[model samples]
Target: MDLDNIKDIWSQENPDTTPEISLENQKELHLPLEKLRKNMRKEFWSTIVLFVFIILFLTFVDFHFFKFKIYVITLVASMMLITAFYYYKFFLLYKNLTSVDFNLLENLKDLKFQFKLNEQYYLGYYIAFVPFTVAEVILIFEFIPGWKNLTGFSFILYLSIFCLLMLGALYVVGKWWFQKFYGKYFSQILNLIDDLK
Candidate 1:
């Protein structure tokens, strides 16, 4: 065979057309995505349930002081806003994640976007709770007769310490929650993308 003729024939084949994936192979490829979708949905519904419970508690439970009621209302309102915004975000993520017809590169790009978005969301979500946590401490001081004496620098110190501790705990818990739910699948998808590359 002439070398130039063989090279010309090989180069004529369509390079853009990907091989058709077998059903079993496609299912295997999508397994991580399916698991991620399930976990995200579970998180979304659980958040809804928790929000409903909080609303019920705030509406039904009696707080003798008007200030306490106002605090609870504020807390609920903030929580509602945060939850709504994040739910929308989660919905978009779910929609994108479950979408089909994407090739390997597109899938990898989407996954990387999701991983980064989630990291930002996790940070914002935890930071958003800081105000409520501080409010709880304020309410405790306001209501509890014995603790009312905490004031001036002492109160400031106590509040600062408590807030810092709560933030630290929230950070740790958020990391663990994400790691447990999405991190494993993220790693798998990353590996798949790498292997494809």
Candidate 2:
């Protein structure tokens, strides 16, 4: 065969495989995406159930102190509201899993944005609990007779220290919870994105 004919044969024989490789990468993404969606849905439903139980308890149980009841109910309601908002945000992310409309890089960037947004939401969610923590301390002092012994600067000192300690503990616990629920999938998605590069 002539040189041009040989070149034509070579070109046709070794057609570009880029599209095939892209399809495979898209397939690879589905597993992690499904896992992330499944996990989010599970957490969302569980949170709803928990808040329902809390609402029922708040409705039925009569704590002798009206202020205690008010504080506890308010705290639970606030938590439920925050959780609902986050879950709505999460659901939006989950819906994106079904469509592979974006290229791999774009998807990775979007996922990274979601992960960071969620981390912020998680921190804020925990921070929201601080007020309730302080209220609990206040209720104990006001209603629980034994705590009356702690008064003046001693009371101020103890409450301040306790609130700080509780807030710190909450931060740690929230971090752990996020890691437990999300760390594996987050790492997997990151690795996949890196592999694409």
lDDT of 1 by residue, 1-197 (tens): 89999888888886776544345545666989889899999998898899889889888998888987997798889888987887788788888887755454655666677777876886788788888887887787778787788889988888788778877888789889988998898788667665555
Q: What overall lDDT, based on C-alpha atoms, would model 2 receive against the true structure?
A: 0.75
Which candidate leads the pack in lDDT?
1
Per-residue alpha-carbon lDDT of candidate 2 for residues 1-197, written as tens digits (9 for 90 to 100): 79999999999888553322276776777787778777887888888788888888889988988877887778777777777787777777777666645354765667767766776776777777788777777777777777768989999997888778877888788788787777677777778776776
- The candidate 2 region of ten consecutive residues with least summed lDDT is 15-24
- Residue pairs with clashing backbones, model 2: none
**Residue 167 lDDT (model 1):** 75
TM-score of 2: 0.77
